[model samples]
Target: MANRWLRPEVYPLFAAVGAAIGICGFQLVRNICINPEVRVSKEGRAAGVLENYAEGEKYAEHGLRKYLRNKTPEIMPSINSFFADPNRS
Candidate 1:
């Protein structure tokens, strides 16, 4: 008697189902491992703004020092005014 459990037609179906499950599992693992942290809180936004402001301050200071040393008339007025009163605008 032929073994019904070892049917040749069912092997392809089993292989296809196993392959799909493996693909889904791989995608799930990849998403969990590679996703970045997201910051959505008000405090996180404020911290980002403060960080940007600090970086801008450093850049402005460097530019002003360079301008002073070179005495570039084109950049002098704006940089000098900004340093003289940073809160003006």
Candidate 2:
């Protein structure tokens, strides 16, 4: 009866879910360890007054944000470029 669950149709669903969960887990771990805003130790905490909140935010940017920082913010760049004439100044 358990063999009924082994059908080929469910493999992609399984892989997709696994990949999503794995990516989430990896980002979670990465944030917990590397993100400067997330301090795990007592010693890691700031003791004195600091004014550079943006500095911590600078280092705290997630993977996706870092990747998209330089790239144009668009849903479909190719399509937009095709519709937008380059001659218009």
Candidate 3:
């Protein structure tokens, strides 16, 4: 009877089936999204999968700034600022 489908035991079974199916589908999606093999770039191409130009530019700028910051100038600051008495003549 149609009323049998509305029984309490049937609802729990249906709920369990729906939850299992939902979890399975979610896992499949997560695996596809996070799996390195599945998230690969085009065949033999040099470009990255995300194609994030801003990230690349940020790294480039960071490297340039770091290089300039660590490089020493030819002259020392103390020698350049040494006092010379012009009135000694």
Q: Top TM-score: which candidate number?
A: 2
Off-target runs (Cα >4 Å) in candidate 3 are 39-89
| C-alpha lDDT of candidate 3 relative to the true structure | 0.65
On residues 1-89, what C-alpha lDDT tens digit does candidate 3 reach at each position?
98989888799999999999999998689556654434445662454465666755664566558777866663665554454434443
Candidate 1, residues 35-57: lDDT per residue as tens digits? 22223566754665344556455
**For each candidate, what is the lDDT?**
0.65, 0.79, 0.65
Model 2 segments more than 4 A misplaced = 45-55, 61-67, 73-76, 79-89
Candidate 2, position 79, lDDT: 81
Worst 10 residues of 2 by lDDT: 42-51
How high is each candidate's TM-score? 0.36, 0.58, 0.39
Between candidates 2 and 3, the TM-score winner = 2
* Preferred candidate (lDDT higher): 1 or 3: 3
Quote the positional error of residue 53 for candidate 3 in Å.
Answer: 23
User: Clashing pairs in model 1?
Assistant: none
